[model samples]
Target: MARTPSAMKYHRQSEKRRLDNRARKSTIRTFTKKALAAADSGDVDAAAKYQKVVQGLVDRAAKGSTLHKNTAARRKARLAKRINAAKASQGSA
Candidate 1:
């Protein structure tokens, strides 16, 4: 229901940005899940690798304003904790 020309253009731009943000968020979730699965499976190396990728994605999302800074930091911290725990268990095993 964008009556004015400028408003119509703004709506289009907003839609594009919305789709892009959604895609980025989905990618973040996919990597996060992969990292968590690797950690749960006790693959320290793979978990660490995936965690690194997820961290980068999260940082990028936060920078782009797709995710809040604190949210990104919290996620990274949790991922690191899981990886560390997996590493400790691996060493003990």
Candidate 2:
């Protein structure tokens, strides 16, 4: 559909960027899920490890513009809250 040479090049570049962004987004989801599962399992050490990974993923996603900064922040906050709650509940038990 891109008749112009420049337009074709731009299309190719955009597709590549889209693929890269998709990969980053997927990675973020996976990291968040791992962190959540660790928290749910009430394993403090594993939760901590996954939390760090999730934080890094969120930062990378925000930096790359694959995710909005505020969205990333919100997700990170929720994940931390869950981890903390799990930790507290385990301590009480």
Candidate 3:
């Protein structure tokens, strides 16, 4: 199939957006991992900080359509659950 000028332009735009979205998602994953590790290691302060950052990123991603709103909500909820559980254990320990 021959590439039309508009189709070629759209392909380039989509490629750039895909890369941007990938980077955003990667950052979210990295921060979420770090946050979970901190929580598990009983570093509550660090975990809280990381969670805050993750929440902000997730919210932005959702708003920008990089992620679905419900998916973002679920991710945030799960992270909060784990972080809170860690805190609870810390208290009992």
Quick one: best lDDT, which candidate?
A: 3
Q: What lDDT is obtained when candidate 3 is compared to the true structure?
A: 0.97
Stretches of candidate 3 exceeding 4 Å from the true structure = none
Instruction: Give the per-residue lDDT of model 1 (tens digit) for 1-93.
Output: 999999999999999999999999999899989988998898888988999899999999999879999999999998899889989988999
lDDT of 2 by residue, 1-93 (tens): 898999999999999999999988888789778888888887888988988988998898898778899999999999899999999999999
Error of 1 at 4 (Å): 0.5
Query: Candidate 1: lDDT over CA atoms?
Result: 0.92
* Per-residue C-alpha lDDT of model 3 across residues 1-93, encoded as one tens digit per residue: 329999889889888999999999999999999999999999999999999999999999999979999999999999999999999999999
- Name every residue pair that clashes in candidate 1: none
Per-candidate alpha-carbon RMSD to the true structure? 0.9, 0.9, 1.0
Q: After superposition, how far is residue 71 of candidate 1 from its true place, in Å?
A: 0.9
Q: Each candidate's TM vs. the true structure?
A: 0.94, 0.94, 0.97
User: Which 10 consecutive residues of model 2 have the lowest summed lDDT?
Assistant: 35-44
Cα error of candidate 1 at position 85, Å? 1.1
For candidate 3, the TM-score is 0.97
Better of 2 and 3 by TM-score: 3
